[model samples]
Target chain A: MSAVTYETEALTGRDFPERAREELRDSQLRGNIRKATTTIRAKTAEVTGELPDWQDLRRAGQAIKREAMRDLARNLEALEANVSRAGGKVHWARDAAEARWIITNLAQAAGAEMVIKVKSMTTDEIGLNPALAAAGIRPIETDLADMIVQLGHDTPSHILVPAIHKNRAEIREIFMRAMGLDHLGDQPTELTAAARRYLRERFLSAEVAISGGNFGIADTGTICVLESEGNGRMCLSLPRVLITLLGIEKVLPRFEDLEVFLQLLPRASTGERMNPYTNLWTGVREGDGPQEFHLVLLDNGRSRILADPVARETLHCIRCSRCLNVCPVYERTGGHAYNSMYQGPIGAILTPQLRGFAEAGSLPYASTLCGACFEACPVRINIPQILIHLRGEVVREKQATLGGRLGAENLAMQGALAMFEYPALMGLAQRLGRVGQKAVERDGRIDWLPPGLSGWTASRDMPALPPQSFRAWWRSRRGRP
Target chain B: MSGAREAILGSVRRATERMPTGVVELPGYRRALGLDPAALLDRFAERLKDYDVTVLRVPEAQIATTASARIAERGIRTLLIPPEFPEAWRPSGPTLVPDSGQGARELNEIGGVMAGCCVGIAESGTIVLDAGPGQGRRALTLLPDYFLCVVLARQVVGLLPEAMPRLRPAIDAGRPLTFVSGPSATADIELNRVRGVHGPRTLDVILAG
Candidate 1:
């Protein structure tokens, strides 16, 4: 990587502990999130209660997503062929750098200085906004939730509701503070109208619009977006140039498969029986939505993820935001705490794959392994399983490179791995620790363990070394030694 | 206009190619669902309500009466309906506008009206408009604040994938197809949700027998 690429893609350098501390400090955001999530959860429960077969829908969605990710290359090729035959341009981006370059050039090729964006998590994953800003182009957000988040210059907190961390009062404040519009009140109707009025002008004037698909139909070459606000309609249709940034996993086998998802997504995320707005376009029809449509199919870390057998299920996420709603950590810190565009359960697995571990190493550990996210997931992604797998990847990242100290983490990991490889060494170490525990113990807790052990004892009290560890007891009882 | 139109269509075709299809069949789907049709619709309606979408069920003959009642109850005037709608089906209190729009956006300006559709998904409670007859255009279902669709239970399809092959003829004929699931919604500001951001605030589905 060059200085320029690293300059853009580098981690924010906000260490995990600091980020967690600062994010946890926002008690108001936490309260707001708790209230909003609980409400949606209740609504979802009430609606899902009506469906005896809701679990089956979730199973079908999960199976479909799994198959799509497993056969990524072939399916994508087929999709490209169908879409090409129908009349669309597909750009394959290998990484964020490539994706950003292609998008900027597409906008530049159209000679557009201003662009409008739909609610797309993929573009944000590639940091498209900063890229546009860097290229002297502006991208405005059309999704009311997105617009509110953008106007506030804030990161999206939830997948379904990026502005979930904010309330009506905060929006009123953001508009007044950022847009300089006065007399803005807190009524939902008035606030929606205010956003509609602001976005109306942008919709009428924006030269291009950027979108993210809920699912890309492989057979019919159709792209789908399920939203509650008609704002998605304006963004998807009104602009002259339409650009869609979609992950490889977003594709489904057939256009008809949308039925299950259309049912599954709303109930899981917003607790709605159905999505309010679902737009499907095969290709540009005469005098219909956006005249010029371009699709950016991003690989970034997907190909790397595809290579992994056990962890590939991580890509099955549909971005329904159900996981985030159920995630205890997400409900606390919101989206920014993840420190990447993709956040929450899907983000925990996806970001490390797309962006790489060196930058997003902390993301996998940010979760409590609480299965609430997985339970809430419409497609039933086993996120906690993927989290442990990615943690292993992060631990073993010290592959032979021209590195200096090998990061204390890497050295500790290597030493542990070495000990695990030898039964004798493992026993020796356990015994040594057991003997050493007396020196460090205070009131049934390690008062001051070794430097590296600080992390373990920092929060909870480490129990007095378990008497004789199970291995020793086993050896003594079974006479295996 | 023709050349620019072709160019646009060409790009769209290219973008369509970017999507992937690797469909896998789920096991025992019907058995898992327990095969209770009416129960599923009830659950669907309940779920729609949870999403802040209004749900209303009426007999086929009562569609006009129910629609008129709903329009008046909601205080929605200046309603727009397709010219193709049966004369007897027109609501009594509202001004009905013809489906013909000088352009695509003309119908979106009207308040709300009923439209005919090709299929309805009972399991999920979605309405499909093949743009045939009273379906008008895509904007007819999308642009208004309160959208009421009269769907016969006989037209309801179990699946979209199953529904597509049947609608392929209309699609091939260049008819604009609109599949509506619920009313427009957004949770954009700090995750606080508000309904009807861009589409209808109220979606009333009159299930005709």
Candidate 2:
């Protein structure tokens, strides 16, 4: 088997728990995320409740995705042929580095000093903006949230709303500094207007544009992008040359499958019945939109993820982010804690699998396995199940290492297993535990312990050991000893 | 690039070697609204209002008069239209400029653009525009601040599923398509929806049966 090269720059340097601990201390971020998630949750519920056949639609969506993944190679080949037949060029990228190189070369070939961009997670995954800048091409983000993130020199914290962690006042500051405005208000209306004015000139002058595809129809060679602002329309239409980086797993077998996804995505993502604009194009047109178009099929760790049957369902995510909104863990810790472009329950499973257990092993333990994500998923990806499955993988990977073999956790588990196999040792240990509890017990709870076991008691209180073991009590009550 | 393509495909093929290869059957679901024509139109108008779009229902013969009054009310002097736009429906007050590969800056200077639609999805209140004869190109409806779309009642479908077949021809012809539900909007600022950001801010729809 060939070794997979996964994305490293986008993954986290620190473990999820440590990062989450730091994120939890930011009261402003907490407030912004809480308000945004709560509002979106209600909106999603209201719109989804209106459709009587929502469950059936979700089922159809899941089935279609399964069918797409089953013959992914064939579907991709068909998509390539169809797109090429329609006067568009297709490129294949094995990893993030290759994708970045291809996109930068294309930008250089176009002789573009500046490129307009539509907000796309695929580009974020590959860190395209920095790569473009290094190549001396100034990439401008046209989406309002993306613009805020770019101008502020901040990373996106949410899937749908990139700047969800920033409130109006913070956004106003970013806009003032970035756009060189003397005065700006904190109201959303004023902020939106300022962004419109700032991006309008760039949109008109942009010679090259980059975008991410939401869905690639294999049958008709069409690419679909959904957005609320007209910025997407501008990036897709106004540029002379266009380039789109699409994840290979995003391809669908037929265009009719949109009948299922188009209904589920908007409701799940932004809690809207439908977004303001959805742009679909087959390929290059004579005089309609961009004269030249390039589609780069990206396989950065996706094929590796497809190898694991249990984890392959992670590819079914449509980036709806409903899971994040409903997740108790994500609602509190937010997206940055996950240390990847993906966050929440989906991220916990997906990151570990894609980046391998070595780089993102701690992510699987980030969730509480509450199953809320599974319930909210449009395609019904069993996220909790996948999290548990990846957790097992993480443990196995750890045990394979020398540090893991002699680790405190492994030694403790081994000792406990030995005691459980012998009844006399088990009884003796229970008696010793009962006596040892006196030193730390206060009333009926043990709030603190020595260094080796204090980690468990740090955030929660443990009950005191009972006077008698359950087996001992049962034997005495039955008059058997 | 071809080497990378082959390697990726080979990896995928190996990964799915154990799985079955036949097509998976899609679930049977309710795909259509099943409403009558009148109800569909009513639902379409209602959904459009939900998006804050201006919906005007007029008789087929009164489209030009109604559009002229709206244009006057909005104080629009120059209106952009596709080359194949019906001459009978052209309002009298505005100077209609036919789209002819105008630059983006030039298109932005126009007050509004009027075009016909391919299909109107009633359930979602979406208007699909293929860059066909009357629709001109994608840039015509875009860049302009105001948009006026004339949707004949016959073009309205009850649901997204019903509209797909109507759009298949455009897909086959390889024309670009745009589905506009409402004027440009954004809720990225603390999840508060602010309308009219980038696309046409004011969407005036003349629904003439």
Highest lDDT: which candidate? 2
Candidate 1: residue A31 Cα off by (Å):
1.8
Shift of residue B10 alpha carbon in model 2, Å: 0.5
True contacts kept of each: 0.44, 0.89
lDDT of 2: 0.90
In order, how many clashes per candidate? 30, 0
Model 2 misplacement above 4 A: A1-13, A419-425, A442-444, A473-481
CA-lDDT, candidates in order: 0.72, 0.90
CA displacement after TM-score superposition, residue A313 of candidate 1 (Å): 1.9
Error of 2 at A119 (Å): 0.6
Q: What DockQ does each prediction reach against the true complex? A: 0.31, 0.87
Tell me, by DockQ, which candidate is best.
Answer: 2
Estimate TM-scores for all models.
0.84, 0.96
